[model samples]
Target: MSYGTSFNYETILICLVAEVLNLLTTFIFYQVLKIPLFFDTIFIVAVVFYLGFVPAICVSIGYSLINSFMWICKTGFFDPFIPMYGLCGILIVFSTWLFAKNKSDFRISVSITLLYLFLIALTSSMCSIISGGLIDYFHYKYYEVTDMMNPIKNFSEGFIIQHYPPIVSYILAQIPVSFLDRLIATFTGFGIYRSFDFFMKRR
Candidate 1:
């Protein structure tokens, strides 16, 4: 929520790097591999651990906006809904900052870090479901994907057809996938942050 009163090229550089890495991660996982998981938030989470809340949130927003722009360029149509998922990244940053800000070293212990990562995964998954539900309601109310290739989407549809609420269905279907996705992202991001911090301290 607050960045100390300072402006520096190094901060700018860090944000730029995080933004690009987030974009590339998204592209590789969601586009090239056609994976259902969104690995894009890895660098954003890393930024939160490296810098703080403000820089990480800025990177998240920048990544979302750039992603939307790229989608427009590729499809020749803008999907406003694409950027709305930035909320997921913001939630992840806030959750991570809340957990790590109190610790002096932020290393804590492996067990504690794993617990925090699991909570983050749960939190991010719920946030994503809510955000996605809202976007669907406003933008794609009657939308239906006929040939859903993603297993999560396919599973979600099973619940939807059973007269369960779409939002609930989405939450149930995505929790497992999102939980695993976020666990990997936060774990890897934390490792990257620790490595970078170690090298910088040695310098």
Candidate 2:
């Protein structure tokens, strides 16, 4: 199967605006939910996952940039946790696009979800590195400039380092939440599309 190689100007604008809105809703939803997952994941996957490669990439990049900026605004500086949203977005989009494009004729099996869940784990392992093992490396760089503010961060870093290697433990710790979240996101996205189709049929 082939994928579109370019996005039109209109497509780019739509993705930018829509993703911005998604980010706001995500922040609000995350505050209320007890589950440990990014709130926008399902919406992003639902809107663009079946649109194939180009749209998925566009939404992922746009969403990630805005999410990073929001984190900076809230925390008064950049946070490692922010960029992970982009990585997860790409994985979720690409996985769904690949499955949809390839299996255009049939229902996706249970294996597809499980396989992408594994991909989520692999991508998140890299998140530990990107986040500097829960900001351990950046602590010395940014924290000093911030005047060692936020003792909670300092304590968490100490706890992470003292008991287990920060990077390893960080990755292991996130797996369960990320796995469950993405699984539900993928299926919930399917339900959303089904609802849309039903409504259109009624119309």
RMSD to native, candidate 1: 2.7
Candidate 1: tens digits of C-alpha lDDT, residues 1-203: 45421448988898898888888887778778887777878888788878888888888889878877876787777666667767777787787777655545446677877777677666766676566545544443444433322336666767889989877776676666667777888888888887888999999
Pick the TM-score winner: 1
RMSD of each: 2.7, 5.5
lDDT of 1: 0.72
Give TM per candidate.
0.85, 0.64
- Candidate 2 lDDT tens digits, 104-126: 33346667655654554345334
Q: Candidate 2 lDDT (Cα, whole model)?
A: 0.55
Q: Which window of ten consecutive residues has the lowest lDDT sum in model 2? A: 145-154
C-alpha lDDT of residue 127 in model 2: 44
